[model samples]
Target: MAGFANLSQAARTWSIGFMEFDPQNAFNNAGAVLRQLSALLVSYSLSFVGAVLLLVIGYLVAGLVERWLNAALAHIHGFDLTLRNFFSKIARYAILVLVFIMVLGQFGVQTASIIAAIGAVGLAIGLALQGTLQNIAAGVMLLVLRPFRIGEDVQVGSIRGTINEIGLFATSLHTSDGLYILAPNSSLWSQPVTNYTRNQTRSNAITVRIKPDADIDQAQRALIRLAQSDSRVLADKTPSASVSEVADDAVTLTLTYWTAVGDFGGTKNDLTKRAKLTLDQQGLSKV
Candidate 1:
């Protein structure tokens, strides 16, 4: 306030001295004006330096807080990695916003007015970004409800892939054939999610048609032996072999077994190959 007053008074004195054409008064006014200008420059220079220091310190503090918050959240059980990162970023941004407000206050700006204006702008932005906000909301719900986790294979609507990353706006996935997919959270949240890896065990079946003349009992015994011999098949559930259909030229033998979900693919392929060999050895070749 005093700096502003001195500057304004010096300007008025200079104007009056020039209008009167008084050489002595003008010389004195010139000195006063220079002094006021020097004082203002020094004051502003200090404020500018202080603002820069505040910015540097505030940025470092924000980064430290983000890291500390992330590390602290890591200890909580069942806390999703996505949520931890999101929350830590929010904290860092909040701190930076406060530091910015403080820096503005150093420039003689009204902090309360700035805060109010910020709120107004935030409201406007929220209104403008409804779809984006929906994605964020859906992302939060996804993290909370845990429909799928990283590295899990899932099918949502028409998209089938392994979960790569769950973010505020989108979920990243890699297809079985290794195609990258960036699906919006809103799309995932609105669809039915099929978590293929959620269950510990999965049931699979292999059906093959045998020669009509083949011995049904022998064929069933061969499939059962093949299932039992494989270590990947779950021991808890007994494998089943049944004559599913009988036709004029062929008979269908269906073998069903339960295997660990992790081994479902390999088990299916291995068992199928072995089943065909076993049936052929038993003289029950397909029609």
Candidate 2:
């Protein structure tokens, strides 16, 4: 009976010791877990705050830099407004991109890997949008070379209109009949472009068919007088009239004159009408 009591007491003591150890170990593990969690929260909070601050500062800095660049470009002589805006926009985006990368770094992200991935994506996108990329490239060249400017009348391909706006990928035009046209920069850059308003003076040729039996000398004189009387004609450029072609039906009289570029269309129409009237008065009938 003594031996059995001693065994029971020993078992109870072992059970109590095990219970105490288990509770102590569990408490220690919980404390350690809480400490680690607190540290993690602190680190994450700081990173979040830093990233937010960086983003705000970066945005403000970008705006300021853009404004400063625009002002500086405005002071430059002969700088195009479109180019100025484009460059300012590029600068702002570049700064913002840098700030974003820095913010990512603050969060322990691998910036180098991200940049590489971005490059790969950009390359893929470039290949997919080859035509669009070409237009952008052509637009940049157009802005630099300045083959034409806004508000100028130009003929590109089969489209003739006045340039309303020049954009990064396309150009807008307004036609004489009140139609709007959007032309890709690539098309304009690849083809021949005729700018009607580039020069100050334009040459006009008017051909009038007169009866073969009509007095040629009288007709020529009348044509020259009519051209000289027109206010739009450049007086310094003397008008000339001659027989260009002789046909079985009639003789073609050619009148060559110079006029101000702006007055070319109006002058040509008026001169043709006046020449017909003058020929009629001279008893010369057009065939």
Point to the candidate with the largest TM-score: 2
Candidate 2 regions with alpha-carbon error over 4 angstroms? 1-53, 77-82, 213-215
TM-score of 1: 0.67
Worst 10 residues of 1 by lDDT: 278-287
TM-score of each: 0.67, 0.77
Query: Model 1 has how many clashing residue pairs?
Result: 0
Over 1-287, each residue of candidate 1 has an lDDT whose tens digit, in order, gives 99999999999999997788978877999999999999999999998999999999999999999999999999998888879999999999999999999999888999999899999999999999999999999999999899999999999999999999999899999998989999999999999999999888899999977899988988888889889989998889999999899999899999999998999999999888888887777778773
Local lDDT at 237 for model 2: 93
User: Where does candidate 1 stray beyond 4 Å?
Assistant: 1-68, 95-116
Full-model lDDT for every candidate: 0.93, 0.92
**Clashes in candidate 2: how many?**
0
**Candidate 2 lDDT tens digits, 125-221:** 9999999999999998888887889889999889899999888899999999999999999999999899999889999999898998888998999
What's the lDDT for candidate 1? 0.93
